[model samples]
Target: MERKKFLRNIVLVSLAPAVWLAACKDTGKPAAQAGEQATYTCPMHPQIVQHKPGTCPICGMDLVPFDKNNKDHSLTLDNSQIALANITTMTIGAGDLAGFKQLNGRLATDPEKTTVISSRVPGRVEALYVKETGVSIKKGQALYRIYSEQLASLQQEYLLAVAQVRQFPDDARFAQIEKGARQKLSLYDQSDTDIQRLVQSQKVDPYVTYPAPQGGVVAELSVTEGQYVTEGGAIMRLEGYHQLWVEADLYPAEAVKPGQTVKVIVAGWEQEPQQMTVQFINPALQSGSQLMQLRGTIPNPENRWQPGQQANILLPVKSKNDVLTLPVDAVIRDGKGTHVWIEKSKGKFEPRIVATGMENYDAVEITDGLSAGDKVVVTGAYLLYSEYILKKGADPLAAAAGHQH
Candidate 1:
């Protein structure tokens, strides 16, 4: 009996630890579950947060698990999200803002390079060598053929005068008459070569062919085949593409004047920018517009560029040196005002409202809310702004305003 009693005591003592271990595990489960409690938030409408997985009532987007403890205005993105958003940062410091004022402009035909071709005599068009507009013509190229009774009579008179001059070489009266006839033919658009050909062929050809006086691209064809043209009437219009005019609009406040050299970047060929001098700035505003006209000339020696092409002019503005500046895209502007996303820590970003001064095409002046050596989100700032709104259910600028207050 004594041995049995001792064995029972040992068994009870051993069982006591097992019973306590079981109770401890049972009580710890609920506490662990409470610590692990998760909340869900809509990516698009973070205001719709719930303790369970469901769709957002406002935006109807699927709710995603979010850290409820993240109450600050700053946002944190993982490596994958950062890479997916293409977020990039740059350290800003005091430096010269080497920026350009971009002005929209277009290429145009230089009026000084345009020419109008006209007929020297009334005639009936027999044929056209260049039949259509936009045809390229070279010097001495046959332009058209014309048939006229007047031309035929002039050729006959020229032939008679040449024959008389050959027969009566000593007679001054015949020589004078020959010279007058030759001059008349010359006045009627007859070249020396045409007169020599007529004298050689000894034929009264009623149809005469005319040659182009210069090389150009035919811009307009006023006369067609079988169309009669009168003396001094327009036959065709030609334009030289050796140079083009670049015209842009400038506001009254822009400090641009004639003789200023500016950079011109042709659309689709931005790699090769040309330097052009500002030739004219209209003293008065354009009709029905508040902007003034800015004109410049660009050389197109290869004729590769066409008129009416979109172009951009880069005008240099007075740069502010030793100033805080950031990429133009780094700043965000909305109804909440202007702010920039700054790196508070690795993978963490916060919005800061900043006062701006002068700005240019590539950079903006940061007058307040930032200091030198601050890392700024230069790319994908809008993505961060969006993510902040998605995760925080508020505008990043709103937080900035709150801090300011």
Candidate 2:
């Protein structure tokens, strides 16, 4: 019993020291260490950073904490982190708003507005009133003069027939000759003006003048002074300068309805862009491209908007009553789906899957995945994703490599 008591005393003594050492190991070191300062940097310019958080001077952007766990975080020799970074952000919120299906394309002409100029009678041109394309013309304005042997002979026969008709008032030969002469002259564009003038003057007049039917700019000028033009031959192409079209290529699922109002951003123009609507949509997709054509009609009063000009089209879709939207660069696209990083606080970000809808170059519609008040890591989403990849034992390269959703 004394030996057992002695062994118990020894064990108690040993446990007392161990208990004290274990308590000592848990001193406030960890809690004090956890209060370390966080490092922050701008997403747009990674070179920018500060211990005291602030914005970038080059561009106004809020600084976010640099986290190693971010899937977008990458090692670099500059002692600086390289990762997916953006300076832009927006909120997905509930409100009355217009949704859009955006597309990029070039300015084009409205086929309906283009007018082809042709002649009714075949002849060789003697003189061209308009010398070059782009010249404005007016209705009833003389565009050119043509001399045709057929017209000259027809005029001579009409003059003779008119004189013969007047010489015998009741003779059937006179009436028949006059009727044939009038029909021949009419076929050559001898209008009532020309026919009446010939009858009154009792003279044969040859060379004919053709007038423009409508006023517009001469888009194409095929006639030199002496070009022989057949009847119905193309003489010039005239297009109204007051209105035009903007055409954009669209994917199969893009919503584009005729008469739907759309906003247009004209590239390389300083003037305020015009608002218009869809004029038409090609039923068949373009061969080899598999892209459908969407068109919008815009007024060209100042001639500022020309056909073939490059443009970014913002087509209004449905009105997303109350939802969240963010800058397109704010979300990181993963193989499974699109994800965003929600900033919990300093040095903490959580990965979140987001449901997306209509996405334009400027912003994205957050359909079912986000709320109006949730602050997300729009600038450093890729950085946060890096952490998720690490925890899942997944390849960061695979995530970083892009796949369009």
Candidate 3:
């Protein structure tokens, strides 16, 4: 029994050290060494974090240290990552955002410059010099010959009156009658030389040739040879190719008043773009299209600007100088609103919701939410947006507080 008690005492002595150590053990978190307390997170995936350095599970990129100094909702990039993304920045300042606005349009014949050739007297078309449309004719050139019984009867009257005046030289009534008949023939497009010839020959010509009043290309032919026509009947349609009208439809957002300058670029034309003023602006919007119509006149001395061809028009609807502006790529628009990315510090960026006004092809106006000298992302902004969406798994502007000015 004494020997058994000795073994029990020895076992108790071994247990005493373990019991003491247990009593002194710490029940809190593990203590970190000096300078080893930094937390790490994925640069492209901000939600992923680790107590020690590691790689990101989603993108397999090396984990980066968290900048506790940076506020939430700000993205931080290193020099290497910035170079890889080709990120660039610009300082905001005052400038003109209204250079010009581009639009698509088409060229058409100017109605004011179009002319219609018509018969002055009732007659049958004896012969048509212009056989088809598109025939170019010069001013005073013969276009057609017409047979008019009325004109022939007037010629016969003038010839007979002239003979009576010669027979009775002292008769004032006969001389007055001859003068009246001569005036009647001259009123039917008959020149003094044509009347003199008729009086000399004493014969009635059955047909008379009519000349083109203006130089232009024939756009339409209404009457054929042997066709009978009445007074003031349309013979042919002529259009002066020296000028053309470029017509474009303007939306309500791009409406402009008259006298605004427009630059026109004609398709397949080697000449430089021509500039013209807005000639017409419709007061009411079109029914189906909801677009307002406007037009400009373009000179076509060489006939290079053809009707029915496509044209691109740039209208300077409005312009303002000394206004805050930014590159068009800097602004991002979504359902939340328009916003831009601004660099708060070196390699650190934050989204700023902005109110925008006029915008052109290259730049946009920043009406609110920013001041002069603010650095903004001009290039590679979309890449940053993608990173933000991937990291947060949501739109950057989804939160109402994030969009608050």
Against the reference, the lDDT scores of all candidates come to 0.88, 0.71, 0.83
Candidate 1 vs 2: which has more TM-score? 1
Residue pairs that clash (backbone atoms under 3 angstroms), model 3: none
Off by over 4 Å in 3: 1-98, 169-172, 252-255, 317-405
In order of TM-score, best first, we have 1, 2, 3
lDDT of 1: 0.88
lDDT string for model 3 (120-224, tens) is 778999999999998888999999999999998988898899999999999999999999998888778899889878878888996889899888899999999
What TM-score would each prediction reach against the true structure? 0.70, 0.55, 0.55
Regions of candidate 2 where Cα sits further than 4 Å from its true position: 1-95, 268-279, 318-405
Which order, best to worst by lDDT?
1, 3, 2
Model 2 residue 159 lDDT? 82
Better of 1 and 3 by lDDT: 1
**What lDDT score goes with residue 91 in model 2?**
45
Q: What is candidate 1's TM-score against the reference?
A: 0.70
